[model samples]
Target: MQGVEFAKDLIQKEIRGLELLFQSLDEDEKFNEALQVMSNVKGKVIVTAVGKSGHVGKKIAASLASTGTPSFFIHSTEGVHGDLGMVEQEDVVIMISNSGETLEVLNLLPTLKKIGVTTISITRDKESTLAQASDIALSYTYEEEADHLNLAPTTSSTICLVIGDALACALSNKKDFTKEDFHLYHPGGSLGRNLST
Candidate 1:
C-alpha cells in the first residue's frame, strides 16, 4: 500500500516537527504565561478557521472547553456577517490556517485588529500573514512531507490538531482541571457516560 506508506512517512515528519517545537520550548516561562492567561480568562477561547482548518478548529474548541478552558468555534467567513459579535475583547482568539494566508481569515484580520482582540495563530508557515498578526505564533510546518499538490493539508491539519491538544492539556494541568471539570462540559457523549456518576 504505497498510499499507506506515504501516510506513515507524513505522520513521522509531523511528529519530528512537533518534537522539535516542544524541545525548543524547554524553558517553561512562555508556556507558563500562556497557561496563566488561560486560567485567568474572563471570556471564551474563540477558535476560527476556514475550510479543512475549520473542522479542526471545531474539534479543538470542544477539547479546550471540556478540559476547563471556555472555548467556542467561529467560522472565519461568517465573522463579517453577524458572528463577529460573538467575540469579546476579553477573549483570546486561536486562528488556524495551513498556509496562514486563508482569504476568509485574512479578510477579517483587519476587523479583529481594530477590535483589539489578542490572537494566537497556528500555521505551517511561521512568517505567514496570520502568524504575523498573532501575538503568539505556533508553527506546525513539516519540512519533509512537503506535498505541494494541495495534499500537504492532511499532515499539516494533524499537526495543528495535536498542537491544540497539547495547549489544552498544558492549560488544564496549570489550572488543575479535573475529570469532573471535563465531565461538566461534556455530559452527552460516550465520554460523558464514562465520567458520569
Candidate 2:
C-alpha cells in the first residue's frame, strides 16, 4: 500500500508539473518563434542531445519526421566525431538539454553557426548557455521532480517530450499535413491501414 501511495503521489506531481509547463508556454513568445523557425526550415531538422536528453531528442526527431517535417537525431558526442557532416547550412538544429550546459552540445554550436545552421534549443533554463546561443529557445520550467529523491529526470524529460510533440504537431498543422501525407511516411502499421481507407 505504501508503494501504491507513492506512485499516486508521483503521478499527481507530474500532472501539476505539466500544468505549470502549459502556463509557462502561454506566457513565452519564444515558443511561437521556435515553431516558426521549424516550420520554415528549408533543410532537415537535426536534433542532438546527450544522456537521457538524447533519448527524448530521438523521439522528437521521429515525431517531426513522421509529421511532414524531415528530421533526424544525432548524438552530440558523435557529432564531434565527423557526424557533423550530416548537418548542412540550410538545416535547423534542435538541441535538447535540461541544464542547457551539456559540453558536447555546446561544443558543436560554433561549427553549426559556421555552417550557417539555425539552432532552436529546448531547455528549462532561459538564461542557460544553450538558450543564449540558440536562434530560438523554447523554455520549459518546473518547480519539482516527480521522483522522491528529486535526482531523477522524470518531470523535466516529460516536459521536453511534450514540447517536442507540440512542435511537431504545430508544424504539421502549419503545413496542412493530412492523414494521406502521414501514411506516406508511416505505411507499415494499424495507423497506415486506417489512413489508407
Candidate 3:
C-alpha cells in the first residue's frame, strides 16, 4: 500500500509539473499548427522514439490511427537502418524524447531535413537540439523536486504519454472521427463491439 501511494504521489507531482510546462508556453499556435498538419496529412503520421518513449509512441501512434489521423510508430534506432524509408514526403514526423537529445533520433534529423518532412518535438526541453530542429515544439515543464528516478525518465515519460493522449483526443474531436473508424482499427473482441455499428 505504501509503495502504491508513493508511486501515485510521484505521478501526481510530475504530471502537475508537466501541466505547468504547457501552461508556460504562452502560445497555442504550435499546437494548432500540429493539428492542422494532422488534418491535412496526405499520407500518415510517423512517430519515432527510443527507450521508454518508444513504447508510449507506439500507443500514441495506434491511438492517432484508431481515432482519426492515420499514424504509425517507428523505433528511432531502427530508423537509420531502414525504417526511414517508411516515411513519405507527405507525412509528418513526431519525435519523442524526454531530454529532446536522443542520439538515434538526432541522427535521423539530417535525413528528415533533406526530405523536407515537417517534424514535431515532444520533450521536456524547449531549448534542446531536437526541439530547436523541430518545426513545432511541444515542451514539457517539470517542477524542481519531482523525484525523477535518478533523473532518468520515469515522471517525464508518464507526463509525455498524457500529453500525447491529449493531442490524439483533441485531434480526434477536430476531425470528427466516427466510432466506425475506431472499429476498423481495433477489430479485436469486446472492445471492438463498442466501436462497431
The lDDT per prediction is 0.80, 0.91, 0.84
Ranking by TM-score: 2, 3, 1
TM-score, one value per model: 0.85, 0.96, 0.89
Q: Per model, how many backbone clashes are there?
A: 0, 0, 0
Model 2 superposed RMSD (Cα):
1.1
After superposing candidate 1 on the true structure, give the runs of residues whose Cα lies further than 4 Å from its correct spot: 1-7, 27-33, 146-150
- For model 2, what is the C-alpha lDDT against the true structure? 0.91
Q: lDDT per residue, candidate 1, 2-103, as tens digits?
A: 687867766676677677666756743544555566667788899999888999999999889888888999999899788998988888888899888898
**Candidate that beats the other on TM-score, 2 or 3, i.e. the better one:** 2
Q: Please give, for residues 117-196, the per-residue lDDT of candidate 2 as tens digits.
A: 99999888989999999998888778888898897889888989999999999999999999889999999889888888
lDDT string for model 3 (30-121, tens) is: 77778888788798899999998999999999888888788999999999998899887889999998888889999999999888889999
lDDT of 2 at 148: 85
Ranking by lDDT: 2, 3, 1
